[model samples]
Target: MITLSAFADEISPLPEEQIDVLARHGIKHIEFRSIHGKNVLDLTDDEHAQFRDLLRQNGFGLSAIGSPVGKIKITEPFEPHLDRYAIALKLAEFYSTPRIRIFSFYMPEGDDPAIHRNEVIRRMTALAGVAEAKGIRLFLENEKGIYGDTAERSHDLVTAVGSPALEHAFDPANYLEVGQDIDSAWNLLRPQVGHFHVKDYCTKTHKNVPAGQGEGQIPRLIADAVAHGYKGFCTLEPHLVVAEKFYGFTGPERFGDAATALKTELNARDVSFA
Candidate 1:
């Protein structure tokens, strides 16, 4: 069955309210972005315990920890980031989640893509080693302005890492952000995709749009993944709603409008957790 999970950030930083909204929407799974008023990697043990308990009581599964683990400079040494990854792995174990979402660090201008790419693979492999020991999967998400922005680059990174613990958390909208063809991107990364991110974007205006209303071929992307035997959570990452706050520096009212629009689009697609 295709289970739908919402990205907690879509509902903002309020856990209690987020949980209530998710339950109202019939969503039983969630990919958490932050915890205890801190990034996932910065959560303390007590925070982790409380978070785990809250989700358990609500009958919600922690699908993955949206860790900002590797979304730094690719030139920087891996040791500092490894420490963050350690914490994230521990948190995942605490929550009993089998996976964590990661991002490829941004490479600076004039930097050699080849050199940074190799470094990314090396660092990811090391992180994968930690995940292997903990029996967890490290899912790399493609993001604009990052080294692994395109599916081809993501595939190369994973292939170079050469660890089964590493997999792709495919986000089609991110590809659209960088002007890559979404369908081709899906074809490139489908084999290594362990999870899915349901999002959409508009390239002409460089704006994030609600699912199914933008250039992202969401239905076709899902169909392609299903054709490839992907039976995993089609995680709803309503980034278009949150992008204003995080990117455009918009207000809460904007978030409310975007969320309502998102819910409407999801309904039109006949996509629901219930």
Candidate 2:
């Protein structure tokens, strides 16, 4: 069965509210990104303990640590970012999840990503080593302006890293935003994808929409993956109310809408989700 999870903080900054919304939507897991307006990497020890207790009480497991592990610029200092990656690993263990979402570093604007390819691979390799040592899987997300933003580059980074610890976090809307056809990107990255972020994109309006409402072609992707026996987390990352570089907001009601949109797709395909 595909497990249903979400970036619950998109519903509210408060942890309690985040849990409440997820429970209401029948989502038993969360892609833990933030709580109390703080990133998961920045959560203090006490806060971590408290949040764990809350999750335990609410009967929620974690799908992954939604860490910004590789969102740094390719030119930024690396040692500090590695320390942050360590924290993300710790959170993954604390939550008893083997998954941590990451990214390929951003290339300088207007420059060909090839110029930064070697550096990105070096940094990614270093990170993958840590994940491998810790027995954690890193789901490298393809984000706009990032080196792995395209299916081809994402395939390259995953192949070059060549680590069992590294895999792809496929986001159809992201590919659409970058002008890649969703079907083509899916075909290219299907073998490497270990996670999914459920959001749709309207090519005509250049806006994010709920699943099946736009050009993302989400239902077909879901049907295909299920037919292929893909069992994994499909995390709802609805940027319905606001889509920003660092964070997004959908609010409680729209977050519910996003969940419904995803559930509808699953239902149409006769797929079960927990």
Candidate 3:
């Protein structure tokens, strides 16, 4: 089955409220991003223990750790970021999830992403090494304005890393945002894609919209992924209420609407989700 998971913090900053919203929506897996207004990477040890225990008690399985492990600028120092990743790995272990969503670092302003390609690959290899050491998989998301924004570059990064710990997460809307076609994206990265992010790109506004209501062509992608026996999470990254660079918020109603919209596409294809 194609399972559905969500970055629950989009519903609320409070962990309790996040869980409540997921329960109401029948979402059993969480793409743990934040809780109580703190990023998953910044959670205190005590906080981690308490929050993880709560999830265990509630029977919420984790689909991935939505860590910003590689979301920094290409020019930023690497040592600190790698240290931060240690914490992310700890969280993944705590949640018992093998996958962690990540990014290839953003390029310097006004510089062609290609200029930093070699550096991006070097850093990505290092990041993949961390996941490989910990027996975890890194799901590299193709975000706009990053080194791996295009499917082609994303494919290159994962290929260069050459580790099962390194993989891809296809966000059709993200590809559209960067003027990359979904067909080519799916063709090139299909072998590497571990999952999808449920959001659509708006051609007119150049913003994100609910799946299937915009330029993402989400339904087609879902059908193709399923046809190829891609069993993975369709993680909801709905930026419905507000969109920003670092993070976004959908609130309860908008978040629920986003989930419903993606579910519509899944159901249209006669696919089942957990």
TM-score ranking, high to low: 2, 3, 1
List the lowest-lDDT window of 10 residues for candidate 1.
Answer: 244-253
Clashes of each: 0, 0, 0
Candidate 3: the clashing residue pairs are none
- Candidate 2 has an lDDT of 0.90
State the lDDT at 159 in candidate 1: 89
Question: Model 3: runs farther than 4 Å from truth?
Answer: none
Higher-ranked by TM-score: 2 or 3 = 2
Residue-by-residue lDDT tens digits, candidate 2, 175-240 = 888888887899988989888889888988888889889887877887788788889998999899
**Once superposed on the true structure, which residue ranges of model 1 sit more than 4 Å away at CA?**
244-274
Model 2 RMSD in angstroms: 0.9
How many backbone clashes can be found in candidate 1?
Answer: 0
Best by lDDT: 2
Write candidate 1's Cα lDDT for 1-274 as tens digits. 4677777656657778767776766678888877445677776777777877888999999778878888788877778777778778777877788799998888897776776766777778888888887789888998877889887889999988888889999887788877898878877778899988877788877777666678887766666666667678877775653464122211234434444555565465555433
Question: How well is each residue in 93-208 modelled by candidate 3, as lDDT tens digits?
Answer: 87788788999998888998888988888988888887898899999999888999898889988998899999898888788878998898889988898878887878898777
| Best-performing candidate as measured by TM-score | 2
Cα misplacement distance, residue 92 of candidate 2 (Å): 1.3
Give residue 169's lDDT in candidate 3 (0 to 100).
Answer: 89
Task: Quote the RMSD, in angstroms, for model 3.
Answer: 1.2
